[model samples]
Target: MKTRSCFILMGRAVLALALSFCPLITVQAVAAETASASALENSVVKVFSTLRGPDPYKPWSKAGPQEVTGSGVVIDGHRILTNAHVVGYASQVQIQANGAGDKIPATVLAISRGMDLALLKIDDDSFFDSHKPVPRANVLPDVRDAVLAYGYPTGGTSLSITKGIVSRIEFVRYNYPVSGLRIQIDAAINPGNSGGPVIAGDKMIGLAFAGALNMQNIGYIIPNEEIDLFLRDEASGTPHGKPAMFDTIQTLENPALRTFLKLGKNVEGAVVLAPFSKEADYPLKELDVITHIGDFPIDNQGMVKLNANSRVRFQYRVQQLAKNGLLPLTVVRNGASMKVSLPVSSSHPMLIPSLAGNYPSYFIFGPMVFSRATSEFMNVPNGNPQILYGMAFAGNPLMTRRGDKPDAQREELVVIASPFFPHKLMNGYSTRFFSVLYSVNGVPVRSLAHLVTLLRDQTDDLLTFRFEQRDAEAIVVPRKEMLAATESILTDNGIRSEASPDMLKIWNEKTPAGK
Candidate 1:
């Protein structure tokens, strides 16, 4: 009788407490929500970008304008952190504070194309004092922990905030040929939500970047660690973030390749099908089997299981090793384990000397095109044989072929096409042999930088091209002659007008101000 009475009394006490503070709990919740709303409005900034599109086939036509919208967080008084792709190839860029209508023009400060991170600075001085800078958190949270993403999503935005949990800490690839430490979140990251803050409590943990195209609620962010590295590299005046390539042995899937190398099932190693660059030749070989990179052993599946329970595949091993250019690796050949050093140099040799802001020379005097043969276009057979010269290294050429066994004894010439050519011309050309070019008219070619410089200096009545080719005489083609022929052919085929943009700069800078 006493125990039963005690239980009844305890239950009645709980009911009395719940009834007494129900209204008070509701009031506190409302107050807290109001405070959060005010903070979000003050923290988020709206990004405005001017995008451009051209006729894919025309080279002399102008481009049309488009608008891109996104969100950003001010991490420092002068600098804003965001994704590189958000503002890439943009013609104009500006930012708007929450509740403000005026757009403040912004200039890109620096960009890490390999990592997809960009730093921008708004020209307005008032922005520094108006927006409070959010502090970056050094320590990340554990899985299943709550986090908030603040951005101007597709929905009505005073600064839309979404809540989700940490899903994974993975070493996954974001874009092809670029991979690194990635934070996978269960947050809904959509079109306009990119470049926003992924915050925990009051601190920022990462920048929202990419998402799984086929999956729902699966998005990826570049961790604060990478952000910190970017800032550090900026301070030290070093190129941003980890290396882009690595030098390691590849484990081929072909059974005949394994048999040719005299390897058995008991062998635990990978074959070196190709080297990253010429520098890698000092330490790597065509048939060498790689056993390790640093202290991590590579399995037959080409997976390198790190000591920390995380795993990274060897597919991008060349890029990672190229981060420093002087990376060390361990390999096993014929049951012998040995250490080797590899050099991370430019894969394309002839283009390296000319890549530093110089344009190839070309002259348009009569009716012919003049340009030089580059290593870029000549390495392939039957692709762009018009301008190929030399056959010195006849076996395995570097970068001519994307993959396969090394042939160190092969050589080929490079070629280039005019920017104003018909887009249909590229349809049948499946290989890169026709792509290597330096100049159009008396202009020195480096990268595409020559194109912008040449276009701006276009004052000549005729454009002449001088190209290098093996066996065939170096020929000069005139611009007007080609144009007349092109016009006549197009008119006959009932086609008119071209889509190529003549005024646009083709350099890969994210913002127009970058040039």
Candidate 2:
């Protein structure tokens, strides 16, 4: 979707006509409206941030600095509330008051990248003395309720206010966090308007964040309920990334399937296809039908009512729980009804991680570069489809488990990142770049660190590296010759270090116990 950028320019002809018809308007009513708008404007401020993000392809390097501008509102606890994307990688932040010329320094105090919310603290306490925090509304505004969007959009140095109405409130996917539950409004959400407050009278109802690319005047806002959750999570002082259900569920809308599952007449629920986590205590099982999540009764479409007027996906109910809490679920398994307590926590680990935090992890031994498979890696051109499929289905218990060994379940996938230049040591070897590793010297590689340990602990004369594809032959290398060529390879390639800094740290910590 296209991000809204640049301020909207108003036509001079429309302005002239409005001025010409000004005599028809009541002076008292206009005065009261202006006064109310001015009061709300005081809480809004412009945010400027300088960011430097890491390069995904070259894990050892960092990208150039980038400058971004957005808007924020003063919230409770003397903090400024804005979008996480605005200050996520910010090295420096400055806040400009609505009508002030001076820009005060600020620091990010708490951030939730998943929720796209961040809280900032002003360096000087005096800023709060003049600007008051806007109170959040406890209840969501009704559809078509009049609202105002306050921010410093593009092309304007001063605060700009736009009048609009709440067009819709539903569970729409939020682009940043890749989650759902958003508010749609017709007010324009230009680039500079991000993080600004959506005001309904005196209370703040939402935060302007994203806009639709294919449609006009379609902007999105983070609803007050989600903002409340973000603030509460920060107040807890513990990082709980994001709460997840950890199960793949499907709607039980098919009457035939529902009947085959023995669901009672008029019963509504969703069927669990698989639980992502392999933990023994995981509550849900395949084919189990979830009838209720907490007090909300799920319908055949896998939706639950938020109130009498609104219903959203059942996952929303799970998102409301605090970390490490229990989500009570009512399920029907094999025609028997039972209550199950599912643990509420962040996403479980997979062979390939969905989100690679700031930098990816990698280790380079001679010309062979080994790195953990991640979503970023899969996006590279000419990636192996088989490896991608394995990563995608890594959550399946049967697929992840290797052979009959109890410890054969791999937690992560390590792959050959790229093809190394022709070398005497690797002669006659046809490398399969991006291929998943099978084992080294007959021992399974569970993680990237495990591979390091396996190589370090090897006592054989030659190392045997196997790939996942059966047709691919093993790569055999003489230990002594390979070790002698490592330094030459590094020097020829002008690599400052053999491995990334994080890998060096892991190697140091994993050094043999008494060595």
Candidate 3:
């Protein structure tokens, strides 16, 4: 009986030892998985960009280089995901792997300015083999959920991952202050962290884009949906379509127009300052009041009030378009409400480009350069006297989020300028498009091509250019020396590229080959 009892005790002890060892083996497996992930992080890299100047013209200048730093995640063997603004205008770009020597050369694959997302491609892919592209989780994490932001920040060189929570997911512009989109997270993001990945539970929820300068611990991201859209656009060759533009708009400042709409008590509408080319097609007049956009009501200040109790007014119709691009509008004319289809155009009325394309074609005579009127170059103020009298129309909207004020003094629309103009018209030609130039001897000044053609054809000691400006001014430029004088003036003003119609012309082409 004693031998049997001893055998039972020995068997029970062996069973207990086996159970304990099983748990130890499981813990070791989990630790190994975590270590593997840490090793995969080496695939991520840091991107640095250096710009020569504010303009693209002097991109290779030796002046102090303006540097921008951002984070990038390896999406594939050779591709990285980042923010467009981080390297969009960069003249030179360098990418550094965690343990690599000199940075690698990188090129932009695609960019979505509205969404603030960009894709980059590198030459080699050997650095990432066992890596996996972070999966896009369908469900959005609620506010206050645990979140992680991975990137290379200011202090350290290698990958830095910070932990935080989702404070909110509101429709806010991720980069541009005037625009807004859906973003998540309460992570504290800084300058160098712009293009990093915002992860939740080992899944990519969004891409870090911007942070509020006035607020602490506040950052924004581009959600995974935007990333999907960008990838699809890359396959399609073109991204999302650009917003449609209208030509005329008006300020809501006049008391008569405001009182007619009963705006002071309960204001609602955008005022029709003047029409672009299409204004003649609508019943809108200079003083016509625009009360509602689609269903969004306007306030007395000519602003579309969104969440009025919150006191937020939007300047561009683009914001409304971004909210919902297709919507009807209600306009008030002579104290009567009339519904009209709202055309999408520039917020300023006078600058609407009657010319085709975003950039205008230019004609150059020796040094004298001329371009047609476009929405961007026009800076006319709202409610011009000519508009009120029904003799004039604006090419842009009346209100905008641009730096120029609605009350800015407008110059006349000049299309022609020449030294042979009557001295009286020449005095004010600089102020209007009436002084813009078209051609030198019918060379068809359609682009930089026309300019180059004319320069090569120059043999006459005295050259003449036919000029056309608004307000019925036609001028002829004579004497080749006068044209040379104009070139000197342009160079002194730091205007290097005469091809672009906009003042911010950076890209230039001296010949067709250069283009």
Candidate 4:
């Protein structure tokens, strides 16, 4: 009987091996887990948007209608929260509840593109009766915490769920509307997962918005803090936007640099490189060392303590302030400590306007097309180096200002958008594309409208166009001949108007009567 006891142990081991090889058992386990996750489907919805935006190159026309899909979650007040990019420039928006067939019409109530969040209201209140709003978490989640992403990701119709963990939480650049703070996770956030909720233990910790293309399983979330700021702004009835820190700053990490600034032993701060705009005139100057913002003391890395254990970039404090509010600062200047207040607002009098969504304003005079130089234009392939340099260094006082010469007073860069089309009036000149216009008839071209005004008032037979270059190329044309060919050029190019609608209005308001 003792020798036969080995048979019982072998039999038990054989039974365990049989269970491990059973596919049916594993299938049942996965099915059970999926059933448990289905409860979250009610709070998520699929968003469909139809967008039509203006064409940047063709200012007078609009781009074709486009259909896009995203995800949204029900929030308080019978409103839905989604990414701003999903509904931006949208002509119509429709929301479909998970596992439902009807698509309810919705409208954007408020949108903050800078934060990449938008709120929508359904046309029918009954839509909310069946779905429950997801609860938002009060604080950020810790690293390695398990999270579930619920959305209608691409490649399927029904709601999808993917399990992941909190990978990182820090200040990361957001792609849309430029960069800002963002959260990262090691989840499969795909094309249609945008605006979906990242749930941790039945509470929403983050909103899935973007993902890294180069790396696998890396996604970004618009954290709850930014969402709260947007909601607060909406409730205040006077939302301006996130406050901007216009002062360019660098860390005083080098010991020699710190010693030169008289930052004795433990003093840590960031050195001001330059203030970008005049509106930032809290009298901030170059070489000023910023040691404190509000009550937060900044370290040499340009970071401030968010908590006893966590620290964030110094700009986070500025972003927390209300727009147009005053921000207090402690700075070391000329080896002396001083306190100052800086206005909290975005840059104004911008020399380079963003052309991401808006159309570029343009005016056509005969064969030459005049348009304002913008960041979009500067990015054109194989663009003029001089024009790009001029546009880039236009406002930097350190680079543009020389000896008693005041900062370049030109407010906008007006450029010839196209190479000279063959015409008798434009002959005898090599018309380079993107040549910045310096002056018209001895008058400095301040802006596009100013150039138009200068041209409108010109009584001389020969109209001279001076360009901003080392050679200072000049283009001379007969005024009467240039005026006579405008209509023909418009007709040949299939352009409906001589100038953009805004430019036409400007010309009408500024041009003299009966000229």
Choose 1 or 3, whichever is better by TM-score.
1
In model 2, the Cα lDDT at residue 485 comes to 73
Q: Each candidate's lDDT (Cα)?
A: 0.59, 0.77, 0.57, 0.77
Distance from true location, Cα of 434 in model 1, Å: 8.0
Question: Which segments of model 2 are wrong by more than 4 Å?
Answer: 1-32, 99-102, 152-158, 172-180, 276-282, 320-324, 354-356, 381-408, 418-433, 459-461, 469-496, 509-515
lDDT of 1 by residue, 374-445 (tens): 322233433544332232232212234433222322222223333333433223333222343424575544
- The candidate 1 region of ten consecutive residues with least summed lDDT is 350-359
Q: Report clashes for each candidate as comma-separated counts.
A: 56, 0, 46, 0
Q: Which residue segments of model 4 deviate by more than 4 Å?
A: 1-39, 175-179, 275-283, 321-324, 382-408, 418-424, 427-431, 470-473, 510-515
TM-score of every model versus the real structure: 0.61, 0.80, 0.56, 0.81
- What does candidate 4's lDDT look like per residue over 473-505, in tens digits? 688887767877888887876889878887888
Can you tell me which runs of candidate 3 are displaced by over 4 Å?
1-26, 52-65, 174-180, 241-481, 484-515
lDDT by residue for model 2 over 129-177, one digit each (tens)?
8788888898988878888898888788999888899887787445323
Q: Where does candidate 2 clash, by residue pair?
A: none
